[model samples]
Target: MATLDLSAHLKEAKKHGPQARGISDMARSLVGSEILRIAGEVKAFAAQGNKVLDLTVGDFSSKEFPIPQPLEEGIIRALKAGHSNYPPASGVIECREAVRQMFERRLGLGYPVGSVLIAGGARPMIAGIYYALCSPGDKVVYSLPSWNNNHYCTLVGAEKIEVPTRPESQFFPRAEDLAPHLGQARLLCLNSPQNPTGTVIDRDALSQVCELVLAENKRRQQAGSPPLYLMYDQVYWMLTFGGVTHHTPVSLYPEMAAYTIFVDGISKAFASTGLRVGWAVGPTDVIERMSAILTHLGAWAPRPEQIATAELLNNGPAVDSYLAQMNRNLFTRLGKLSGAIEALKGKGWNVDCISPQGAIYLSLKIDLRGKKTAEGKLLRSDEDTRKYLLEEAGIALVPFLCFGLAEDTGWFRASVGAVSLADCDSFQARLTGALEKLS
Candidate 1:
C-alpha cells in the first residue's frame, strides 16, 4: 500500500486546485472595488488599536444610526407571522403596492403596481436594468466621479462614455454635458443627491435633462432605432438638506415617463443598507423585462424585510419622523466637517469643501499635492494625500479616484452615515494638526 508522502501530496493538491484555475475573460477584465480596497487599509489601521475615523464606506453603522423603530418592529412581526418563504419574483404584492403609493404620495408620480420591480437591493435592480436594456457594445453614458456606473457598464460589456463633470456644476451632469453622447448612447445613467458629492439636480437642470432625453428619444423613433433609456437613481432623494429639493425626470417632463426608469430603495433613506430591499419604477415593458431577469437571478428581497419596509413606507408619520431625525444627524456631521475644512481654507491651508446640500456625504478638497510632509515626503497625488491623512490625521476617507475620477483629482468623499458628531469634531482637530505639519 502506498501510504506515501501525504504532506507532499496535500501541498501539490493545494498548488493545483480548481479554485486556482483561470477565470473567464469578462471576469478577468473586471476591477475589484477600489473603495473596498482602501477600506481594508483602514481596517488594518483600526486593528492596531488606533482610533481611525473610517468614512470610506457608503453604509450605515447600525449602532450609530439604527434602522427606524417601526421598520425593526415590522420585521419582527413579519417573521413571527412566518414570512420566511420565497417572495414573489417581482415582490410581495403588499410591498409593491406600498412602493406604488410611496411614489404617488411623495414624488407626485403615479406609477402602477405593474411598473414596479423590487429586488435584493439597488445593485441588483441596477444590474437588471443593464441586462434588460443595454446589449453588448451599446454606449452607456454617465458622469465620472459618480458611483458604480462604470463597473456596471463593464459587467454588461457596454461602451462607457464618461462625461467629466466640473465642480461648478456641483459635480452633476448638465444637459449640455450629456447632449453629445445622447445621440449615440443606449442608456443614460443619472444619480441625484448624487453619491460621493452629496449634490442634487435642481428643477431647471433636471428639466433640461428630461428635455434632452425626450428629444433624443424622438430622434431615435424617427430613425427606427431603439430609444435611449434613462436610469435615474434617486436612492438618496429623501436625504436632501437645506433648501435642496429632489427633482425627478418624469415629474419635469411627462414625455420622459416612456424612457425613464427610477431606481430607489430604503437602503439609504431608512439606514437599512443591510436589510436588502430596493425597487425600480418605470415603463411597464421595461420593468417587465427587468423582473424577468431578476427572477432568473433570484434577487427578490427577503419576504420579512419587504413586508417591514412596506409597513414603514406606508406609515406616513413614522416615515416623516425617521427622516427628520436622520436628516438632522447627517446634516450636523456634514456641516461640522465642511465648516472645519472651510476654517482650514481661511488660514491659507490647502483645504476646501463644497457645501453639502444633500445625502450623508461632503466633498472635501485636500490639495496637498506638491506639499512636503514633516518627514520630507512630498505628496504628489491624491493617493499620497489619502495616505498622509489616514496615517497623520487618523482621517480616513475615499478619494474621488475610487469613484472613477482621474487619479489627480484632489476631491474626496467623507460619508457621515457611520460616524458621530463627536467623531467629526475629533477628526477636525486631528486634521488641523496634520495640516499644520505640512511645510
Candidate 2:
C-alpha cells in the first residue's frame, strides 16, 4: 500500500491563509463573540501561574456550584437503567408532561402538554423561534445589551431592530421604546433576570410590554397578517434575589399566551449547564412549528437527561430547597461585590454598580476613560478599560460593549456564578489597587 503526502499542497494553502471565499453570506458576515475572546485572554493569563479572578463567562464553576444532588443521582440511575437511546425528536412524554404540570403549578399557566417543546437547551429553542416564524428580511425586535440576539438574527437572515435601553430602566426596553417597531416586527424577544445586567423587570413594566404585544398582534390579526410572537427567555428565573419577583407575559394576560414562547432550562437554575436540557412553552400550533424546524437540527435533549430533568421539576420540595440555598449563596456573593463597588464609589473612585437584583451578575461601571495609567497610556474606550482591569487587577469582566451596548460606557458584567465569597472579597482589593494605579 502506498500513501501520497500532500504536505506541499497543505503548506501552500496554509501560507495563503483564509480569504473569505465561497462561504455563505451569513457565515461571512457573522461576528465572533467578544466575551469568549476576553475569556481566552483570562485563561492564558491564569495559565502563566498568574492569579486571576475570572468573572467573564456566564457559567458556573462546578466546584463553586455543583448541579443539584437529586439531578445528579437521577442521571446516574437513568443511565444504570439503560436510558441511553435517543429521546423522541420532541422529547420524552414524561418530561413534556412534567413541564406542563410545572407551568400550571409554578406559573399558573394552564396549557395542554402539546404546548411544551423540549430541546438541547434554550439556545436551540431561541433559534427555533426565529427559524419557524421569520422569513428572510423579516424584522426581529430586541433590546440592546441583550445576549446573542444579533447573532441569531444573522443566522436566520432576519432584519435586526435593536432598541437602545437606559440604565435607569435596568437595560430593559420599555413599552414606549418598543411600540413603534412592533407593527413591523415578526418576533419580539425579552429576557428577564437579564444576562449581563442581572436586573429583573418590574411587574408593571412587564405588564405594559405584554399589553403592547397583545395590541400589536390584535392589529395584525385584523389585517389578516401573521401574528407577532414573543420569545421570553427566562433561564435565570429561579435565581432572583433582594425581594424581587420574576413575572411572565402569559401570567399577566392569559390572552397573551396565544403569542408567547417561554424559554427555560436547567442550566442557570440548577447549575447544570453541561447537562443540556431545555424547553419552551408556547401556543400548541407555534410549538409544533418550532418542533418541525428544530427536529432537523437534532436539538432534542438527551433521553436520560430529559427523564432526570422531569424528575427534578416534579420534585417541588427538592427544587424549592435547592433554589432557596442557591439564592442565598448567589445573593451573598453578588451583594458582596455590589457593596464593595458601592463603597469604592462612595470613596469617589469613579466606579459604581447596580445593587444585586436577580441572576448571577452585577452591572458595574468603572469609568477610566482619559485617565492616565501608571505607564501614561490613556484608556479611551470600554475595551481599553476592560484591558486595564484584566491586566493590572487580575479581575476579568465582560464589558457591556460585548453585549452590543454600542457605546463606550465603561459598564461591564461581573458574573458571580463561578466565584466564591472569598473570590468576591478578592475582587474589591484588586479593583481598588488597579483603580488607584490609574491617575
Best candidate per TM-score, number? 2
lDDT of every model, 2 decimals: 0.91, 0.91
Candidate 1 clash figure, as a count: 0
TM-score for each candidate, following the candidate numbering: 0.96, 0.97
Candidate 1 lDDT tens digits, 1-439: 9767699878887786544655666776788999989999999999998899888879999988899999999999999999989998999999999999999999999988999988999999899999999989999999988899988988999999999998888988888989988888999999998999998888888888888888888888899989999999999999999878898999888788899999999999999999999999999999999999999999999999999999988999999999999999999899999999988899888788889899889999998999899999999999999999999989999999988887577899999998988898887799988988998
lDDT of 1 at 323: 93
User: TM-score of the candidate numbered 1?
Assistant: 0.96
How well does candidate 1 score on lDDT at residue 167?
85
In terms of lDDT, model 2 sits at 0.91
lDDT of 2 by residue, 210-282 (tens): 9999888788889998888999999999999999999999888999988899999999999998999999999
Candidate 2: segments with Cα more than 4 A from true spot: 1-21
TM-score between candidate 2 and the true structure: 0.97
Cα RMSD for predicted model 2:
1.6
Q: List the candidate 1 regions with Cα displacement exceeding 4 Å.
A: 1-22
Error of 1 at 332 (Å): 0.4
Worst 10 residues of 2 by lDDT: 14-23
